[model samples]
Target: MLSYSEQEILAANVNPATGLATDYLNLFNEAIMLFEMGLDMPDMAEELADWHPRGYIEHFEKSGFELKDVVIAAYEHAPADIRGEFDAACERALTMFDTSIRVLMTANLEDPAAHADLSDRLRDMKGLVVEMDSHIHGRSPAQKSLQSEVDALF
Candidate 1:
């Protein structure tokens, strides 16, 4: 369904075969950074709480990513089945992240057990990002892990 020329999409940093981009993953990175940092710095909790979920196109539109338009168009044109799987995976990651934040907000980071548990949850979130990264790179990602990871983490 994507009509963009190979040159154009690649120029925009999108993987032509997958019609997917990596810039979107950077958004997840920000959340991970904040939460991971929050584990040690109690003050970061306020900043981490502001992190919220956004879908692919919405993420690009709101972000200052240089190739926002191209990324949005490519995502819109991505194959239905792949996109659906990707979106479901993203939704799972999003839910897990949001839930982790809510739990972190109430948890006392100073406590050893709570701190360790949230760290484990954050690691799973990072794993989901790796899965997303693999998908964008046109690698044969084990998509099943996306769901199972969410099940274990969420």
Candidate 2:
């Protein structure tokens, strides 16, 4: 059971409904940004080499998020169904990022085919990010308002 109530978790900037913190999404965003940039500019490909996958917990622990401890605790206690689905999405995203990085390292970016391939990979990885974000949003029809309310507080 969660030691902190939903209200407390919400107050800490963690989503009480999904038991997730949005801060983790920034990690994925950074990877996506690198991929997008590299696809547009050949010289940016080196930036992808520096991108590494970081798990949700690792992100919070490494970041300066003030509520990292609370967010991590809430995530640990999140319902199994929600956590499982979220984890699956995250795993797919990580693999996609790794695959894209390999392509960047080996492929000739000047080839149109390579550009198309990377574009497709970026689209698919973005889809996974959306799936992962849905979990953070509670995947509920009613969550929009709740998230908005929570957002209003901070």
Candidate 3:
């Protein structure tokens, strides 16, 4: 588990600009709070549903979620002449992917049979979007189809 001081340092490193830093800082802090709450209790969905989106806790709960947040900040700072737009889109996809992972993780740990279905849905979405990335630059029909599906998901 990450300490508050560590999280703060990470947030500072990830968000340097004074203008828009607060939003990014909030995002990371919220994720960390939700993750810690989830870790403390197994019924994460219930614990976080009132606080935020159901899957957000799980999505931001992982070790790599902070890194992904940094990636988003970099995309936000990228030059217009560079691949900023594409990078931002990719970052969005990754955030969605992480959210899906958290939802699936919670669903798997859920006792109710209904949650299993939710888990399956999240897992399917994650798998589809991740698989589509490999073919993003390709012109094959399969690649085109996957990209379409991934875009729809994002």
Candidate 4:
């Protein structure tokens, strides 16, 4: 499980309702929040674990479901007014990834000592991402995909 401070840091990265992040780091951080929330709640975990168009649609069809179900249904079938919000968020996140790459490429690298320190910090970040992904999704395909993305980042 993530520590309280870690959870808070992740939560602070994005707008919960729209899942929007201001930067590339926050994009992954928001994903951490989603994975953690689903892991901490049984019903949510079940829904996430069985996540697929058919399964979610079936869940939506069922009547008298729990709050989690309703929330997931609403998200899947977002109101027409907000239907493009998620897509826009995704595009913004991808643009931020490019910005992050540019920052990394142009970072000051004059000091060898500082380079070593930065390397260590990036390694730590990679470890945390892997740990969080494992804790939430175990060895599922989603975990593998997430791990691959984190590996590419660091």
Expressed as tens digits, the lDDT of each residue in 1-154 for candidate 1 is 6666788798888887777887787778888878887888878877977788988888888988777788888988888777877888889888988999888878988789999999999888888887777677655566545554343222
> Model 1 TM-score?
0.85
* Model 2 weakest lDDT span, ten residues long: 145-154
lDDT sort, best first: 1, 2, 3, 4
- The superposed Cα distance between candidate 4 and the true structure at residue 117, in angstroms, equals 0.1
For candidate 4, write residues 1-154 as lDDT tens digits.
2222433433433223332222333334543343344333323433333222122234334524334333343344434334353344334444443343333344444556645554554444444444333322223224566445564233
> What lDDT would candidate 4 get against the real structure?
0.37
The C-alpha TM-scores of every prediction are: 0.85, 0.83, 0.30, 0.27
Which candidate ranks first by TM-score, i.e. highest?
1
Q: Which candidate leads the pack in lDDT?
A: 1
Query: Deviation in angstroms for 54 in model 1?
Result: 0.3
- Tens digits of per-residue lDDT for model 3, 1-154: 2223435534544322211122223333344345444543556645445333222223334435545454344434534533333334346545664574366445545456645555454555444444323222222224556555444333
lDDT of 1 at 17: 73
Candidate RMSDs in order: 5.0, 4.7, 12.2, 17.2
The per-model lDDT (C-alpha) reads 0.79, 0.77, 0.41, 0.37
lDDT of 2 by residue, 1-154 (tens): 7888667788777878778877777776777777788888877878878778888888788888877889999999888898888888788888888888888768788899988898999888776666677778787323445454334222
Off by more than 4 A, model 3: 1-22, 50-78, 81-90, 101-105, 110-154
Where does model 4 exceed 4 Å of error? 1-26, 29-108, 138-154
C-alpha-based local distance difference test score of model 1: 0.79
